[model samples]
Target: MIINKILNVDDYYYDVFMAISGTLTGFSANELQSTGLAETYYKHILGQIETATFLEFLNVSKSILENSFSQDQLRNAIQSEIMADPGMQDMSNNIITMWYLGTWEGTYVNELSYKESLVWNVMHAHPPGAKQPGFKSWAVQPVNSNS
Candidate 1:
């Protein structure tokens, strides 16, 4: 149930990602990668969830990251969120799978094998080239999504 709630929050984040990119015309792959929107979008989701005490509902100990949420649980939450949207359902497995691989093998994996590779590959390929305008740190840090 807590994962479900988290998934709902992630779904909102995904929607925001789609909305931001959808409005762009001739949005080159480089531009998409350089925009660093996914990182911003994820942080926005975490902020909303934290502000709403969504994690508190899970009763996870704040001291430990692994104990707070197992990798499988996180994967399921992401998959569930992706599948709930018509536009994302078809790509849910690819998205979740890539995130899994990226987390485990490092985002620099040279042999990615999923459509979601496009997503992570782009992020990895064009990491935050310069400091993001409003944020204090680079957007594409390794721990961005894990938290």
Candidate 2:
């Protein structure tokens, strides 16, 4: 399985890659652990790295999946980019987490009530719960936005 293959890799970069990929693809850790796609994805990620930078690999992967770039083309691009920026070899879990958040739109979360948000926040930060604390105690107010 892809998740197993990724988990087996001792490198932190591979771990971060798997995390980001799972987040982007909406695959839970359990799902990834059970499926073959995780390994396929990991191998694809390995093929994309030349100088072995996490960010470059992520950029290439994002372009391939999000912008519809071909896997081979994206891999080559990442290889050259990594060669030029050798300092990008490390991966930051926080950065990957943020990337995952930005990539995954939270339409449902935004519509949640304050109480719901609290419940969801306790279970998971994303997809905030629909009810808010003291929902019955507060008056509903409207705010203006330029958008």
Candidate 3:
């Protein structure tokens, strides 16, 4: 239920999370809940918006979702809003980073497996310590994933 509240979806919190995350962080939330990462993310978000209330963030998320803004629009608006509300912006980016990195920056109670991380897709590279293609792989070339 809290997941739905976060994404402002009526049902299928995973799908809603997938959409919001894909839109917000450019990562998929598929299987994230099964790994318990979704719950951890929800807690992190709830903590970030605890100042006024979870409902405050929910109201904002609901408003944003109702508009069906494009990902760029959502990102730009959030980027601008960070000036006015830095904490929420940091929290939002942290959420995105969680989707991206599969880990939070600071200490947290929940455990995460870096092996399950998603940033590899964004970066178009191999995970650290996972493998080495060969000597000088980095020197030769790497695809420009962002482009």
Candidate 4:
């Protein structure tokens, strides 16, 4: 089905994208938006997938958002509706990888993507060369963040 026939891409596509992304990544929409790569990643994913497939993914995302009530329900819906679909597997993997590693298809999307990669946050560290702590800061033992 042609996407534009039923849904307006220019209006709510990104919102749906963010919602689905947040569910898939276990991050809040606010945290994902804080990276400043929402638009960048949205456009990038759109470019990477066939329009028909991408639209279906968006529709499923919207459905998942509207129907899911709790965390388990959301995750189950994603696993069944999104991950189980053969057509969506590559794109689903890409979204997760993109959010965590800041790469699409194993390549960095951009410098900003690298700088703001979620992996660094998960590790409680900064991306190397993206942010400088200070001269000789690394020489000092890093504090145990988990303590």
Q: Pick the candidate with the highest TM-score.
A: 4
Candidate with the larger lDDT of 1 and 3: 3
lDDT by residue (tens digit), candidate 1, 56-136: 321221122223256465445444444455544433332333333322223422332222233444365322332233544
Candidate 3: segments with Cα more than 4 A from true spot: 1-19, 28-36, 43-54, 69-76, 80-84, 108-111, 130-147
- Residue 53, model 2, lDDT: 58
Q: Candidate 4: deviation at residue 68, Å? A: 1.0
> Which pairs of residues collide in candidate 3?
none
TM-score of each: 0.19, 0.31, 0.55, 0.83
RMSD of every candidate to native, in Å, equals 15.8, 14.0, 6.2, 5.2
Best-to-worst ranking by TM-score: 4, 3, 2, 1
Quote the positional error of residue 41 for candidate 1 in Å. Answer: 12
Candidate 3 local lDDT, 1-147, one digit each (tens): 123433444444334444455556644455454444666666565565554554454455545555545767666655554325766566566656777676566544344545445666556676678645678786765685453
- Model 3 alpha-carbon miss at residue 139, Å: 16
lDDT tens digits by residue: candidate 2, 80-134: 5433454532332322222233211222212212222222332443343433445
Candidate 4: give the clashing pairs: none
TM-score of candidate 1 versus the correct structure, residues matched by position: 0.19
Error of 3 at 82 (Å): 5.5
Name the weakest run of 10 consecutive residues (lDDT summed) in model 3: 1-10
List the global CA lDDT of all models.
Answer: 0.35, 0.42, 0.54, 0.81
Residues 1-147 of candidate 4 have per-residue lDDT tens digits of 111212233757887888778777888778998998988998988887787888888888888878888778888888898889887877788899999999999899988999888888888778877787678786777668453
